[model samples]
Each structure stands twice: as C-alpha cells, then as structure tokens.
Target: MRAEPESAPYARLGGEDAVRKLVNRFYDLMESEAQWQTPLRAIHPQDLSESKEKLFLFLSGWLGGPDLYVQRFGHPRLRARHGAFPVDDRARDQWMACMLQAMREVEMAPELYVHLRDAFQRTADFMRNR
Candidate 1:
C-alpha cells in the first residue's frame, strides 16, 4: 500500500482559528513573561490587541489559507517592517520561547506541534536583523 501524501500541518490543525490561538498565546507570553517583558515591551505597542489580530490574519494567509493579509495590507515585507527594531539572537530566542509556550498551551497533535515549532524557529531566525 502507498503512503498518504503529507498534508500541510496548518490545514490539519484547523487553519485560521488554530493560528489565531497560537498568536494570542504568543503575545500573552510576551506580555507576562519577565524575560521578554522588557525588550518586547519597548518594541511592541502599548496595546497588543490590534497587533495580535494582524499576526493572526497574516499567519492565516502565510500558512496557505486565505490571503487575508495581502488583501488588507498588501505585501508582507516582514523584515522591512521589523527592521526598525534591534532584533538580535536574544530577541529571536525570546520570541521563539513565547511561541513555543503558546504551542504547548494549544492542543495540537504532537507532530503538528513539532512541525510548527521548527517552522517558527526558522522564521524567527530569518527575522533577526541585528
């Protein structure tokens, strides 16, 4: 018997809603965690509500769902937008730590969790400008 083709984990994880939860938890950690509180506090806006929504919408399209971000905000030159900040290894690691904690809080399949974590790590690394 042939094996099934691997579907994109994002789709299997329920797409937009799952992605939204992940983003929400990530920001929650940034808001609460001491290690991240300082750096992220300076970088992020006083209110993260809109930022969280934007991330959720952006990830919805980025994970191969509806292109909501582009439809609303045009191109997502992520690096360009984030370039204004000093994102070094410490910042990247802090972001990943928050994301990982968020992933754990969400009830995703283990395989999907690992897949998403790895993907986020790579993306976070790429986002580092300093």
Candidate 2:
C-alpha cells in the first residue's frame, strides 16, 4: 500500500468554481436571514454583488490558487479592512452561520467539508474585533 501525498483540500474540492459557489451561498444567507440581517446588514454594503465576487477571489488565492485578489486589490489586510466594522461575538457567530450554511450547500466530500467548515469557523472567530 502506498501513502498518497498530501494535497491541498482546496484543490481537491474543485478550485475557483467551488469557491465561488460557496461565497454565493454565503451572501444569499446574509441577504435572507433575519438573525444576520441587523449587524451584517449594517456593515455589508447595500449591494452584496461585489462582496460576493471579492470574497470568491480572495478565497481563491487564500486557498492556494492563483493570486487574483492581490493582482486586483493589492494586499488583503483582512483584519484591517474589517476593523472599521463592529465585529463582536454575535457578529462573528452570524458570519460563521452564513459560511456554514454556504458550505452545506456545496457538494463536497465529507472530510473536505468538515475541514473547510472548521477553517472558516476559526477564521471568522479571529476576525471578531469586539
């Protein structure tokens, strides 16, 4: 038996298209859900179309794909960019909820789904400023 070389889960999960789908689902949840509507609605732009695209591109590079975000938006100082918003625990949790819902919508392998969800949860927690 041979051990398979470790692969980036992002690659195994289907790259850019999959990432875009996930972001789209996330935005959909934010747009529709009342729990997330207050804080998210205030912080997020009136139009989330660009937000979805930016998040997709940002995730593409963050997940080890081509550096499209940098090419277009320069450095992604995530914390800095988000600093302007009041991201308390509630806000972070709502963000995670949206992301988790989005992950569920994607047809990823179980292990891949767990890994991605955990990673997103941790990152969302880290982004909490309050």
Candidate 3:
C-alpha cells in the first residue's frame, strides 16, 4: 500500500502496480477489442509498447503519484502532443469506452472510478479536434 492517505486517488488505486495494470488493460482492450479497431486503435502505432509506457507514466502523475512523466519528458503538453491525431467524437468515445472498461476490470473503487471517469471525459472532449 502507498504511504499516501487512502483518500488519495493514487493510494486508493494501489499505487504503481495498479496504475501499470490499468494502463496495460487499456491498451490491451484497444488492441484486441473489435469496437475500438477503427480510429481509436488506428490512431495508435502498430507497436503499442511506447504508447503503453507513455500512458503509464502520464497516469502515474495525473493520478497524484510520482510525476514520472514530467520528470522524464518534461511538461506533458497534452494538446500539443496529440494535435497531430485526428480525434473526433467516434475516436473519443472509443477511447473512453476502453478506459472505463479497463478501470472496471482492474476493480477500481466506484467513487474513484467515477471521479477519474469525469476527469477523463473532459480530457477526451478537449482532445477532439473535429
């Protein structure tokens, strides 16, 4: 268990191990799930290794754990990094579906899941360029 209070999303999430599990599950679903085979999976690289690591790092910081992403890559520059991708409603929805399912599969607490879901929704909405 993490030293952070249980109320901390990172601690409630079981710290680094849980975060890794969530990221892996999210990418696995995107790769294997038929529903995400279009724009969502298509937007990703043929090799998901880099993509998975980036997300794991980003989520680690975003969820209030160590800021590994920023430490290693500097500021996330989220919009700038994702600007090249053609993100639309369909792609956003597909991403959300996979993430929501991954969270559930990882057995995240309902309250924390809802909180992260809302946060992710806003982020995904902003990612939409069309």
* lDDT winner: 3
RMSD to truth, every model? 4.6, 4.5, 2.1
Using Cα atoms with residue i matched to residue i, what is each candidate's TM-score against the true structure? 0.89, 0.89, 0.94
- lDDT of candidate 1? 0.82
Candidate 3: minimum summed lDDT over ten consecutive residues — where?
Answer: 1-10
TM-score of 3: 0.94
Q: Taking the tens digit of each residue's C-alpha lDDT, what string does model 1 give over 1-130? A: 2222337565767776788888988998898878897566568889998899889878877776777788899999999989999888888888888888988998878988888888889999999998
Q: What C-alpha lDDT do the candidate models reach, one value each?
A: 0.82, 0.82, 0.91
lDDT ranking, best first? 3, 2, 1
lDDT of 3 by residue, 16-98 (tens): 89999999999988988898999999888999999999999999888888888999999999888988988999999999999
Best by TM-score: 3
Query: Local error of candidate 1 at 46, Å?
Result: 0.5
Candidate 1 Cα misplacement greater than 4 A, ranges: 1-6
Winner by TM-score between candidate 2 and candidate 1: 2
